[model samples]
Target: MDAVARVRWAQVGAGGHVARRTSAWWERLVAAREGRAPQRLVHAVLEVVVDGSVRSVDMAPTWGRSAGARRVVVTGPVGSRLLGWWPLFRYELRVVDAPAPPDHVLHVSDDLPLPADVLDDLALVPALTWGRDEAGAGDMWTSNSVVSWLLERHGVTSVGPPAGHRAPGWDAGRCVARR
Candidate 1:
């Protein structure tokens, strides 16, 4: 196998209009209670380069069945007859080629020299309950949790939200990954 070239991460605005607005409002409320100014809300995604090919890793809602080969797992209350019936309640871990990150990207981390083993572990992230505070990290699991979980699994701990910004559920991922 060719040596792994590079790994980097991008912090982007939440994908949908509703998600963006809701995240902003929630963060604002939390910040206000803590006596700090609200930080810009963001989500994390990874871009990995190997043998000159770029692959993006992220978790997203299973809106449809078109994820094709990129979808790794569909997780969340799949056994519950209520939530299992709706795609909105399920999420997928995806590794897509030549990914197009959402608009309004907030920050991009410097490239990290990661080992190839980390890529092999991408599909192995635990299928934790999404949108639920399963880790007791004080926040619900979301895409940010997935990214942080993968990073933590490989001992990459310093990557985080940029200055004056926040990525909710980040700590939750790390918390769960550590167990």
Candidate 2:
């Protein structure tokens, strides 16, 4: 990574649980730099729109700091809420089409309500679970189910600790390449 290249991460759902994890990592990244190393910042670039206007921008707090970002990690829904935060992050979102070093990681649950066409448009694949166990249905992905499906299909690696792990400030785990 370039010294000046800011680690860019984007969260689609800022209000969700996964968004909190992403934000925690961003905050930690910023602290690690301490004005010396390159900055690692997340953004709420995409918006989730249902009717017509904006709905939510899950990763808005990330845009307040660090300016250089190269990748987007979507976790929640993208609708009208997210549209409002687009100006903060001017970088275009790149959807990973295959197994690769994911710029971001998303949550994949079974309960979220997303249109079939939208899911098809993104070409998402189920993270694949052996049915709910002790963790119950919620034990699945930590972020939005829609984002999780897209990530699993494209083979993008997730950063930071798993949904519930160590302190909020830290990468879940090194980028995991599927194939």
Candidate 3:
């Protein structure tokens, strides 16, 4: 609205962009634990496919820079946090194929309806959900409440309950289909 306010706003915007581009949690955690710093995060486009048709594209997290992470935590609300709910979905990532995701994600699977925590701990690399919400790309997500915030592109979302919920564990594998 004012000159000073505009300058402050621009500064804040630039800082936010810098933070997002920094190494993802997994990269920092693994590199620190191993007594080294990761050179970069591997960015990959998750292509959910079935019947040879591209179904969806989940931009996933900034941590996408790393390959071979078998486990990743999808965050959600944990009851009330005095102010209604937690501020930001604290997404914790564990590459069991790296180690330790629970300590960061906070909530555990024992409390939720699904074994989401464990599934994330033992998930296969490049996993996915069943498929399209069918309401068209715009409204297909069951509950994009959080993902709408994390996705770096166009504020994305997908089927609710995270991919691990419908995964049926690492053995059954994941799926991808378009409407």
Best by TM-score: 1
> Who wins the lDDT comparison?
1
The segments of candidate 3 whose C-alpha lies over 4 angstroms from its true place after superposition are 1-16, 19-21, 24-33, 57-87, 90-179
Name model 2 segments beyond 4 Å from true: 1-143, 158-179
Rank by TM-score, descending? Answer: 1, 3, 2
Q: How accurate is candidate 3 locally (lDDT)?
A: 0.25
TM-score of each: 0.81, 0.21, 0.24
In angstroms, the error of model 2 at 126 is 7.2
Candidate 1 lDDT over 69-106, as tens digits, reads: 57464455432336856887677677777776556676
TM-score of 3: 0.24
Candidate 1 lands at a TM-score of: 0.81
lDDT of 2 by residue, 1-179 (tens): 10110122343234476856765665566557665442333231222334432222122223444444322433222223345356442222223222222235332122223332332333232222211111233332222323333333433334222343222112111111122
Worst 10 residues of 3 by lDDT: 2-11
